[model samples]
Target: MPMLKYLIIILNDASVSFCHYESAKTGKKEAGMISYDNLNKAVAFALKNNLKVNFLYPRFRPGKKYEKLIEDVEHVKIVPRKLGGVYSDAITVLEAGDLRKENKVTGTENIILRLSSPELKILPAAVKEIARKGGRINLVIKDVENFGDSKISEYRKLLAEISGLLIKKSGENSIPEVNFLTDRLMLESMNNCDAGITHLTVAPDGRLYLCPAFYYESGENSIGEIRNEINIKNRQLLELKYSPVCRICDAYQCRRCVFLNWKLTGELNTPSRQQCRMSHAEREASGNMLEELKKKNFKGAKGIEIKKLGYDDPFEIAVKNRYSIQEFKNFNS
Candidate 1:
């Protein structure tokens, strides 16, 4: 079994989501908090496994007891912007609508901006606004599963615009770290959301899930109880080596989200057309940005190159480059 390095403890069923998945609205009356016993067990489990914990919070402040237990270990707090006043040091999550409202950004806070495809137009401006405030933004396209050709084109165009801004910032030596664009430039290998491979989630019921999305989508999809052995069915399918296109492709920073994979392609190892296209758009933009930065003689642009690809979607090339049985085995080896 792969060593589990991180544990995402969902403090409540209504915990604010920080990724592509949607959680119950914070103000919802129906909420389920993780039992104190389960939370204790989870903490113990983390200590035993030497795992880093990330506590996902809801709108309401956790009681002193819960807060005390959380502080017992080193952990990251992921909370909604509304709770920012309470957990001032936490990584904040903001919806697209929230961007219009005045909010305090400490210039050091790592912010996650969750927006849909139609909201892609808001990103370049949002990036500039956040960067001006000295804050870093990581964008999550919440509706990536719905990215058709039209939306993909819009996303690609917006990325080009953002790339131009990033290139300018690079020249000024103030390049802001936007995940999709900058992350790819820095990474040389796949740095995906390896849920079930590198990390797992502890839901309100104290069940182990591949991620919070699996728990929200269906409880039956859970790997096992937190106290028991994690038993992810067809576990190898979750690894990079098992993903044919992903293994060969170089969109290094793509989340390669398994939840989105299972939702859109119905196969954990098979990436959807939407995901491939979206990631490639970002990849192409990153390449352009790198070239611009190199021309400006940016210090960090040395030795990094995102090669241009003939096709935006790896699926196009993957189909023609199918591996034989022995070749597949050797690749995995």
Candidate 2:
């Protein structure tokens, strides 16, 4: 297995979600805090493995005792916007409703903006706000599982408008780092989540999970206990080469969330239509933005190219261009 580079420690069952899945609504009984003993073991495990830790915080503080344990290591904090005043340096998550209030955002803070399909209409304005007051904005569509043909079309149109705004911002020398658009411009290869591949999660139960989403789904999904050797069944399925569509895809910035894959398609390596179409929409919008930037002679846009694709969904391409067994073996070799 590949060496783990990062470990996500979910501080509590009620931890605020900074990603697609909601931690508070997992329907699981409150498992309370990760015991101080397990917490120490987790930290020791991380230190021994030379892994970077990311502490996910809940709405309320974890108290001074937990705070002290967290401060012992150099780590990143992912917290909800409600606690932004407390952990000011943390990567803060703001839901669609949060944007309605008068929230103060410093231009140096990394923000994760979570939105559903209906809330996507506010994205353009949100982008403008972030460009004016934040560092980077990671847009996480909360209901990606519900994205259909019509919603995907609407998302594409919104992305086009967002691309135009980003182009304008670039010309003004104040380009905001919107992950959906800006990330695709610079990524040359697959920059996916790679949950079980590059990083793993340690839930409050002191067990290892592929990622936080898996742990939230079920403790039964844990690969192993944090104190034991990590073992992930069918682990190769998490790699890029094992993915039929993703291996040949160029949506380099797509999260390729494996949890969503298993939930929607019943396979770890296969992606749902919603995921593929949405990623390609971002890729297409990025390509258009890159062209506009090049046309405007934006110096920073030099050397980046997002090529055009014939289809929005990679499954369509994969179906039409199926590889033979020998071809697959050669490709992997």
Candidate 3:
């Protein structure tokens, strides 16, 4: 239950969407939705579970009372640059930027710049700027479900370009690692989105969500009530071992989101087309980055070895009897 070190604390009238995930759905905006009681309880839960809390805030400011409660613990607040001066010391800064605008601010240190794929082309220079800013950028596809075979070629080219930029930057005597490509390069095992396996979300309404995405999509999506008891049916199904494709897939940096799995495959553990493709795209980019970095003699990549696989998606390899999956090996330990 305390497997995840990071827990998102939703503290907003309109929760700020992170670079990679959209939390709130509809146009619901009303500040102070999370009652003080819930705040204290969440804080208590995080302490009891030893999870690091990350708070997502609304566009508007919070009352002093709310601010005091949020500061009681170490946490992260997702806020917009439009609401600048809200907190200079924000644990993680998220910007609501178009692909180009996201590019402009990509260099901010320790910031999450969210952008869609189509917008990426408009700001071809954003990747370079991101390298310049020494920031970590995560590319979030606004409409990942819309991805198709038609886009694969373009996506690969984009990844190659991003890989080139990362390689070029790493040669410049500084670290400007971008999540889409660089993360996988430095990672050895599959680093997937561990939603039900490691962490669970406590919505504003006190229901348990797999992650922030489910809470916003449909309130009917409540898995259970945390206050009552931890009652997620077939909880093992949420773990990686249960996922046929993902367990064997080394596209290790993929989010492998449970919600996206449920949406596409009608199962929590199984991944959808778009999710796998998006992840594989990133994985391939990372692979290329690893090779490019080798060419440039990057040092952080020392002693890290990314396995070479002939296939992009694990599904393909498994379908062809290439390899088997063993899920119990969570390497976080």
The per-prediction CA RMSD against the true structure, in angstroms, equals: 2.1, 2.5, 3.3
User: Which tens-of-lDDT digit does each residue in 1-333 have in candidate 2?
Assistant: 356798899888887787878786442323567877777888888888888899988777887888898888878988887787776568888887787776434323578888899988888887887777646889899999888888988988999999888887775334678999999877777888889978889888888899999988888898988865777889989987789989889899899999999999999999999999999999999898888888787666556778888888999988899867876677640
Error of 1 at 276 (Å): 0.4
Give the residue spans of candidate 1 off by over 4 A.
Answer: 26-31, 103-108, 172-174, 324-333
Q: Estimate each model's TM-score.
A: 0.94, 0.93, 0.86
Residue 18, candidate 2: Cα error in Å is 1.2
* Per-residue lDDT over 193-241 for candidate 3, one digit per residue giving the tens place of the 0 to 100 score: 6776576776777566778788777888877765535677798787766
Best-to-worst order by TM-score is 1, 2, 3
Q: Model 2: what TM-score?
A: 0.93
Q: Which lDDT tens digits does candidate 1 get at residues 132-250? A: 76667888988987889888888888998988887766644447789989888777778888988889999998889999999999999888887646777899999988988787788
Give the whole-model CA lDDT for all candidates, comma-separated. 0.83, 0.83, 0.66
Per-residue lDDT of 221 in model 1: 89
Identify the candidate with maximal TM-score.
1
lDDT of 2: 0.83
- Better-scoring candidate (TM-score), 1 or 2: 1
Displacement of residue 80 (Cα, Å) in model 3 is 2.3
